[model samples]
Target: MIFQLGCSHGLPGIFACLEGAAAIHFQDFNAEVLQCLTIPNVNSNVPSFQRPALQVTKCDAGMEIHFFAGDWREIHKLLPYAQNIDVSTGKGLDAQYDIILMAETVYSISAVAHLYELIKMCITPSHGVVYMAAKKHYFGVSGGTRRFLSIVEKDGVLASSMVAEVGDGSSNVREDQTLSLFFLFLFFNLLPCGCGHQFGHLPLIWRIKYCNRN
Candidate 1:
């Protein structure tokens, strides 16, 4: 299962869908964004004939597509897999995501902690991995890759590695970093985020994973 948090246009989630992920969930802060942009973008890429009814949870391929919109603090209540987690400990009861992807989602310091907590609830406790693409710093907001990593490092459950970095003469450097596992090429192709950094197509990438998976 794959989950893309704070998905604006949901490009990464769409890529996972095209890759034949058994399930892909796209989330955003606004329902309108999902209706006007995310859904349309997905449908444009996935043929109409191939799409199962949105109400249908699963199909022959074990494929499921879901979209959600709400604040990070409370949205987990509505997420199917998140319902399986023990919220107090941020561990799973029955269901959790194998892969979680987010881009430019760490720009607000106030929201970063909530986002991290939500990740803990949704990801598989033992071996789930996360792919995060963001700038090293967000300047005025004081939220960025390093800020988010500080929280992760303090927790000591997940470990991160720099997968790819982009300079391109830009003062603010951005990186595609991960927690653990897998080799895959990410073709981002000039997607610009709110922080003013544009990610170009990247090469083979490594990710971050749980440190004490047993």
Candidate 2:
């Protein structure tokens, strides 16, 4: 089974995992967002593939996709299914997952720290993969992407080849203006690190995967 954390709008990453016939768990902090996800099943842009059965809610379930409606600290309390679990205040999600994902959630330094900690908790001795994406720039803002890169590098996580690239442009209306380009980052666990930290970066698509070592 595969799980997507902080799934918003059901992106292709989550859908692709489903295509592989993996039972999918979709989670989000907002019940309304989870409720809105059901819309795509009824009117999907991708018509060829059947949508995966998605369970959405505000609390953690013993299912593959667990959505916590509050801080990661609170969600950790209810995480189940994975072993070697440890709980800590200000810690992130606590269960090992197959294919964990996040998108457009790391725009601030605090968020980056939280994300890193969350990823650490989800990783087990078995090799796992984490995929993250963030905008290159935002409304003439810079450094967020660089900061994220630095944080990941300092933590010694290996990043795979860039996955997706977006073009740069601007909109006529201020509200619609383009601020940043999106870049994807992939991390494969080669060793175990007992510690994690956070930093700052623009929002992008992020995904994490948990698998059996054997």
Candidate number of the best TM-score: 1
Using all chains and alpha carbons, the TM-scores for the candidates as numbered come to 0.82, 0.56
Best by lDDT: 1
Candidate 1 to truth, TM: 0.82
Put down candidate 2 lDDT per residue, 91-178, tens digits, no spaces: 2234445555555555565556656665666643265565555554444433344455566667654343344444335421111011
lDDT of 1 by residue, 28-96 (tens): 998888776777667666433144233334545567888888999898888887877675667556557
lDDT of 1 at 123: 85
Any residue pairs clashing in model 1, and if so which?
Answer: 178-208, 179-207, 179-208, 179-209, 180-207, 180-208, 180-209
Candidate 1: misplaced stretches above 4 Å? 49-62, 179-187, 190-206
lDDT of 1 at 65: 81
Query: After aligning candidate 2 to the native by TM-score, how far in Å is the CA of 166 from where it should be?
Result: 2.9
